[model samples]
Target chain A: MAQQVIIKVDNLVKKFGNFTANDNLTFEVFKGEIFGFLGANGAGKTTALRILCGLSSPTSGQVEVAGFDVYKQTNKIKMNIGYMSQKFSLYEDLTVRENIRFFAGIYGLSRKIIRERTDELLNKLNIEELGDKLISSLPLGWKQKLSFSIAIFHRPQIVFLDEPTGGVDPITRRQFWDMIYDASNDGITVFVTTHYMDEAEYCNRVSIMVDGRIEALDTPETLKKTYNAKNMNEVFLMLARK
Target chain B: MDNPAISIENIIKSYDKVVALDDISFEVDKGELFGLIGPDGAGKTSLFRILTTLLIQDSGNAIVEGFNVVKDYKKLRTIIGYMPGRFSLYPDLTVEENLRFFATIFNTTIEDNYDLIKTIYRQIEPFKKRLAGNLSGGMKQKLALSCALIHKPEVLFLDEPTTGVDAVSRKEFWEMLKELQKKDITILVSTPYMDEASMCDRVALIQNGRILEVETPEEIVKLYPHSLWAVISSDMYKLESDLQSFEKSVSVYRFGDSIHLSVKDDDIYGSDIKEYLESKNQNKIKVEKIDANIEDCFMALMNNNDL
Candidate 1:
């Protein structure tokens, strides 16, 4: 039952001129684990995630995503991961099935498998009848689900979800997590960044970044106990206030 | 009838084919902090707009501070502060400029209302020179709140003020609201975060233009009609599917890392569910009886309303 470390960061640092966004950050993300990266508005979580995601380069130190070097193997790293942001990234003009096919094609998924997976995904979400419907016509919850399904369509080794459940209601948020669990169960690592305390509690392990450093990292239970807080919100407040 | 700080009598509003507020009615007593809790497109913002005299309802009466929203809107405008869901401050204006502008518009000086918005204003004081657009999310919200309070309104209406805000600022914002509540101002706030429901004195759960329930957080939780249990195992998604296989299960949904199950039979104990998960060959199984919170109650209500 030994877990493999898919993401490895060692003393990673990112600076913007005189400002240090991420300072000496180090962490290990195991395979298929839902690792939460939590922080306040100005915290360096986004910087660290971007480095891991190959979108932004680190100033110094070592970072590897899916065993690919962040600096030298950015293309390889990009291929092994999927990314979704809070801002709905789907094409509003494209139909649901068309969007799926487009993303699948970009990932170089075979046409036969893309057709099969597209049908299966629509069926699983119980939105088969709406496959031809434009993305803009869908509700917020449905759009979120569709975006998530599309993100994992190619079955990347790891998926990066940046505040995936933001603005959705509690029920929709829960259903979104179910989709996350489904992806994780299929051996896809989930690297999520969120401001929602309740969503942080869902992760197997979470790292809290404050003022360009990893303030705390552990299971939700352990972090609660260590900080002597009732919930993640209290834990975040306690750290942020300091 | 008892001169409630704010009262709505069977309000209904619509746009084209969409019913934004469907026969909704509620009351907020003086000095009370009432929350209008619901998701996006659930009529919360529409209700707030009507209450603040910014939008006209198709039917029903809404009164704020004993002044009818539609008839006494001119006077009501002077006595109520409204912080819309979107940040409405001028992006080009500095923090102080926005506050001063809002105060002068109400025919008052910032010094006259200095004590009212002191706490929120101080948070953004250092950034007074910065443009509202350039300020951070938390700072932007603080500035918005300060501007809203500069007029010293009798009642405050905030529509999703904390949305898109980080956890630290959200906690800070709620703390500020608690301080404002002590000033004897009747406050009506709306948010999509259900965890915040418990912070309000009372909340009206709205969805799809209808009021699902209105009660104190504890009272609403007590209304959860079934025994709930928190169930978890090494394999979570599989555990959810396994729990769904139990015919006695009324509802099973994920809450954080654990699955919250509301069984049909109240007599079904936590141990019974644990035993079943064990039979499914799930290891590290943990099941404990737990109380339902506002989010759970809201989901149940939403489902029932859908049916």
Candidate 2:
């Protein structure tokens, strides 16, 4: 059961000069679980994600991903985890197939595996016909879906998605979560941050951060019951009010 | 003088042979809060742009408040307020400065009509000195609303005004719109959030540049056309897959923690669906007949439009 705790944090603190972005945050993500990190805009959700993904440093406390210290094992963590950001973090000038080739190349996938997986992902996403189209031409939803697929192309143990469906419609959002479900089914842990309350209900467990502190964390059902609310939005409102 | 607020007869718009609006025709009732409800690229923006005299239609005619959109573009501009999907406030200017600039552009001032925006402006009054770019998303949204209302135009056009905004802010924004509606300013707003459909006086469900149905929110929800159910069960993936496999599943759409299922016929009983899930080893299966909401009506209209 020791392997179940794929990620653990204790009193994790991150500060940028005088501002403490993340304060004494503690949480644990289980194996094969979809974890949701939620908060308002500028609520320090992004700050905590940056620390976990090794994009920045924490001023104090401890963080361990896949049982490795984030400070000492940053490179190993990068190799073992995938991170999809809020922005479309791909080359807009490149073609669909070329974008996949570039990222898979960096992860050092074998040529045969890259070619096979790239084709499979494109087909599954129903964007095979637009494989030659520039990333700039595709709609917002398609760009987000492709960015997510590219993030996890290397088969990382833990994949973090930061507001993966920010401006997309509900139907496109359903499609994006379907891919996320597919990933988690393959034993990959999904850690996603979103401001959308309905999307928050999609997670196996959720933690709400407010004012640089984690205010609530539990399964969606439990959180709803505990807060005496009907949905995640009400629950967030309840906690934010406090 | 033409008396209608806006008029369009079989207006078609295309970009390089790609049809965006196809023979779409609609009219804005005087002093009516009209809503164009659909997802992204559903021609909501295109329609608003056309009605506001920004883009000319290809084959038909459209007029705003009796001014031909194609012929009297300048006359239409002074009478219609437009708030785009993205915030268009000058980022370099402060909240008050931005409001002042827009008012001046329309040949008015904050002192001229401060009462029109008093409700919304009070919320942002403390931040009047802060640049528009430095404000929060919700604050920027309020500022935009105030600037648009500063001129007190006859018609207001908002394209997905609530997108990217928090729930509280969205609720607040709609309240402000409703308050403004009492003053008889015809409001035409477009949004992708199906839940927001109920807030409007009358809504036109548009998809693929075509109007599916037009009705009041209550009337639309009342005419849901079929019975719906909200099913909650364990092993959600298995339950979802099983529901999809079931022949009775019209459309198993997810709504929060429950999967909302619709049936082809209105008379189908809910107990049968509950029992079917029970036989599939799905625990905690609870399927009860529920009332159809605006979202349900919108989906039904969309599905019907497909046919």
Candidate 3:
């Protein structure tokens, strides 16, 4: 069976004044695939992510997200995608249920559907009792897991996660990855960037960016074999050091 | 015998009703690279603040380089270098300006301490004219470390130095730390990365402001008391659920593409569990015994603590 492509970019270039942030990037993300975007700091991953999320326009390229043109249909693209980062996600001052309702409303979900989904989500996360509690009272691990759940609550076509599991416990980190697996199983295309190499192994495909260009893209096993490396970390060091 | 580099005796701290550090006690030998490993909100920052003389504990005391943290705080401040978790350098100042500012604060000159920070300073010297805020994440870290080392201190404290850094840069940062250790500086660094624990001479696994265990990484891994098996099948998610339901399974965790299954019985064989998973419609099942690493040990220790 032929795979369905959800994100298609050709010669995508993002430049700021004299410096190029993203240099002639081209990649395709298939529907329901977990795509890992790996790179060192200042490697243009953020620039490319901003362009794909419809938050910023590309300097030049043919870019389409969820079948909408980057330049012509940015609003449509934004409506079809969800974004969550470690730096920002939920409102700390609001209760769990309130945060859900607020985000659902922003997505233009109907009140009837929002009420039903809120209950379902709270129960599914086993936080039914904590629904009335403020987000600040929750632990870091719980907050992270809840943030991820809320990011996908509106059921967008693709979810972009930025360092979703940065400093969580080892056990909680794995549990969070389990949630990613569940999302992918439900046909939500996951485009994620993380510093942890072990998380890279969980992705169906990974692309490593270096100095504003895509250095390598393949499955973890193949990348390791190609670089004669023992793991993703070693492969990253080898390519990034060059 | 030489005195320990840093010592904490029953240090207790709290905020209102919440306790940040509960009876935390530990000692670090002189000229050793020690690691404090834990996740965020695990009281790693609170402990660092107390040891660095930034915050006073509610009870108990700490000593660094034979000077009491409370009584000798002024003297202690002059002899210790601390790189906080957040970037505390002046963002508006150029790299060289920030370095010189810190040097002046310590009553020293950049030339007088030139030998101490030479290795780290040389890397950022080319970009000395760049604003501290404009540097990349990796370069910013190098500049921060350089500022921290501007004055030759007996003990160095680094709080989550490699938290948000990429793998490649993280490796390079550790290499720099190793070089600094060779100069007979007692270094105490904290990180949430379990893999970096092995690089330290000894590590303290802390959670909820309480130390879980303190020992060499090798000894800590040896403390894991279970038969661990790495299991992989065509369907990883299903394999994890099936393993969780297995009668002999003690714990099941997803590690990358495979699931690390800990069994209650050491005598359990691979085929025995493979047969059970196969009956549940799992295909391409491969199971092999493997040794526990630092993360595996961390999980095991955390679970035990909760019980």
- Candidate with top DockQ is 3
lDDT of 1 at B1: 39
Q: TM-score of chain B only, all predictions?
A: 0.97, 0.93, 0.97
Model 2 chain B weakest lDDT span, ten residues long: B298-307
Off by over 4 Å in 1: A105-113, A228-234, B232-237, B274-287, B305-307
Q: What is the lDDT of residue B89 in candidate 3?
A: 97
- Model 3 TM-score (2 dp): 0.98
lDDT of 3 at A77: 93
Model 3 regions lying over 4 Å from their true place: B305-307
Maximum-lDDT candidate: 3
DockQ of all predictions against the true structure, Cα-based: 0.65, 0.47, 0.83
Q: Per-residue lDDT of A1-242 in model 2, one digit per residue for the tens?
A: 56499899999998888988898999999988999988766678878888888777788998999778889888888888988875657889998889999998988899999999988998887778988999877776788889999999999999999777765666677878989999999999999987678888999999988889999999999999998999998998777644
Which wins on DockQ, candidate 1 or candidate 3?
3
**Please, what are the lDDT tens digits per residue for candidate 1 over residues B1-307?**
3588998999999988778889998889999999988888788888889989889999999999989999999999999999999888999988889999999999999999899988889878988899898997788888888888998899999999988778777877899999999998989999988888988999999888999999999899988988889987988768888999987887888876588998876888778888888888999998899999998899889889221
lDDT of 2 at B134: 92
Candidate 2 lDDT tens digits, B132-211: 99997888888998888899899999988887665666777888889999988999999877778889888888877888
